[model samples]
Target: MEVNIEIPSHFLCPISLQLMRDPVTISTGITFDRDFIEKWLFSCNKTICPVTKQPLDDDLSFVITPNHTLRRLIQSWCTLHASYGVERIPTPTQPPTITHSNISKLISDASKSPQQLRYTCLQRIRSSIAPATTRYYSSRCKNIIVTCGGIQYVANVLIEKDATRREKEEAVFILAQMDGYDQEFKSVVLRNDDYADLFIDSLVGLLSSESSSNRERENAIKVMKMVYSVADPTRLGSVEHEMFAHIVRVLRDKVSKEATKNALKLVVELNPWGRNRVKAVGSGAVHVLVELLLDERLDRRISELALVVLDQLCGCAEGRADLVGHGAGLAVVSKKILRVSHVASDRAIRILSSISRYVGTAKVVGEMMEVGVVAKLCLVIQVDCSSKTKERAKEMLRLHSRVWKNSPCIPPHLISSYPTN
Candidate 1:
């Protein structure tokens, strides 16, 4: 026969037992609830323990589901419950209907899941909602995170947990993906210029990250370029110099031609020569740039990028001085004037004009001319090079070289008819 207790519904609330409300304990050892204590104390011989007079099992925890006969059996046992762990078999108790606060707390905790799976869930929710709907969610992210702390929880987990190096990199990429379009993203980008430097500094830190794959590093660098595009100097700062050098370093190491192309594009945007500024460290960057000029392994994309950077540097007085001090780059470029195809040769000649005439560079050109770079340049002008190329080369070689002294600054076409080199 089924025996049951008609325990009132209100008595089911563990908090409302006239015992404790909003009960909380950070400690793991806080033992039995008040109900259990009361039950065991009053159970007498009817149950092994007042709180828990049922037969004990080795299971450390229990879960209930509507389909389980055991859950029904446990409910029958609850009517005779005693608080202590050992108990005479007691009738099952009815499970209380869940309440709103409990539901809220459950959701909060679920939302705060620290696993990648949790973010997958959040991303799904975020994508399913309308733009306007997400506006509302935008405000709720903080409190919701606090309750269950999902994104925050994930952030903390990512920051604090021991993940594989590859995992950490994926985590960083995920962070970038998530934060890129946060509706509030522009306020910081637009609201204050000073923060742009901080943002770039942070991105630069990411570029140096070990274990980051080629694709990921390229994306990070692309982000820096894009950020500067919309950024007003008022908001993003005069970071052109720092940005340029870092671009060079990335350009130097980047395996993808596209990365090199993109870097070149950014340098060109800084117009006429972003390279010459002190912060760009004309003194430092020019040497590396020149070395690149000498490296034939560098493609036209890289060479064009270097030229654009040189042009930018020429615009700055300090940059000009820096190149002037590094005469070797121009000397090498001048030497190439003889061997390069028309495209690269003309480009080389133009870059020489771009950075030539600087005081320090003039001396290097002087030494190079003294070493016979001029005759090599003139002989090339005598070859199948374009008229425009020859004209520019003649003008440049004439202006920068001591060897070309008193030599006619004749255009290559005009000189072609009469040259006795």
Candidate 2:
């Protein structure tokens, strides 16, 4: 007869509910399997204890101590139950604990080492340390890494001509993960014109590189967005055309939703300075944004961002011409007026307002009338949209009343609310 052996509930991990292979106790005084807790804390980007529901420190120094006593008990239980087909649990080997001092040394050694060793060190920093430290404990680790000169080391790797492809990718990945958390660091980079230019040039090179992987491109764009957010006005005004081209390419390729959103945001950020609007128009941003909005399945946030970019771009003559020139541009912008969120509606109205106010030639006004944009504006006046939006709609109607008023395109119900001014 076979004997059934019941496992003790206390011997199980709180998270996995399996026999603990390598039990570890968290700061909350709760024991869980090491793998399970690490996954919760690092992989899931969480900082709370699963069982206790207490907030864990957002510090990399927060330690998960090994529960050797519980591990031994679980091992004994498995050993005693060997007859019931339970295999003896082997003792788990602890990984070397990573410390700030060791990380600093590693970065220092890599800084002075040959290319191969440098790559290896960067790989370790990216794969092992950077993700865990930067993802959750950004505020804490940002100061530490910045103090260790990690940022400069990584930037050097990116600008080094002899650096291998993997080395550059890893460097960008680490820099992207950092995400410009330290504003002081950003100020310092911006103050040094040469360093800032070289760093940005390397990131743009990644964006424009055909050999770059999708992940690499995504990270590079993220870093670029962060860098440009705090860039000085002079630096923003001088943004290279190639950078805009690559950003538009990222938008067209739709590398990922995050990448697309960041690219749109980058365009919006840069458009306010110098000839960036023209550069974006030259890079085909208007067409790409219009095409993106035409997709019915695009999420609300992306739609809003796309419209926002279009609104900024439409501030310039080149932008207005490009938007009106695209086949679906006016139609899509009109369609989003009251259909998406308030922000989207606001931006959409602003785009039309720009076209009507500055570029409202007879032909363009007719295009707006034919595309049902006139109807949408009429509807906007009667609807419960923002007062600002309603005013803009009325202004557009009043601007082109001679052509759009009493036009057959305006729905009869909406024509009554059309601005008579």
Clashing residue pair totals per candidate (backbone < 3 A): 41, 0
> Candidate 2, residues 1-421: lDDT per residue as tens digits?
1246677898889899887888888767888887787667653546577887776643222366778888788888777877778887778653424457756876776676644256645654664445544444544555566677777777788888898787798888887777656585485456589888888888888988888889999999988898888887888899988899999999999999889988888887898874988888898989999988999999899999999889989988899999888888898999998898889999999999999999999889999999999988888887788999999989999988999887999888887888777
The top-ranked prediction according to lDDT is: 2
Q: Give the CA lDDT, 0 to 100, for residue 22 in model 1.
A: 19
> Which regions of candidate 1 are displaced past 4 Å?
1-168, 171-198, 209-215, 235-237, 240-245, 252-260, 270-276, 335-347, 360-363, 370-391, 397-402, 405-421
Q: Taking the tens digit of each residue's C-alpha lDDT, what string does model 1 give over 1-421?
A: 2234344343232423432211121112222233343232222111122223442112111111222333234344443464323233333233222233433443354344433233333332232221433444543443333344333333332344343344334434433343334333344334454554555665665566665567666656665555555555443335545565676676667547766665656555444333225555532556667776778787865676676566556566766666556757556666666554566677666665665554425455565555445555666667888888777656766565454544444334444433332
Worst window of 10 by summed lDDT in candidate 1: 56-65
Q: Where does model 2 exceed 4 Å of error? A: 1-97, 128-143
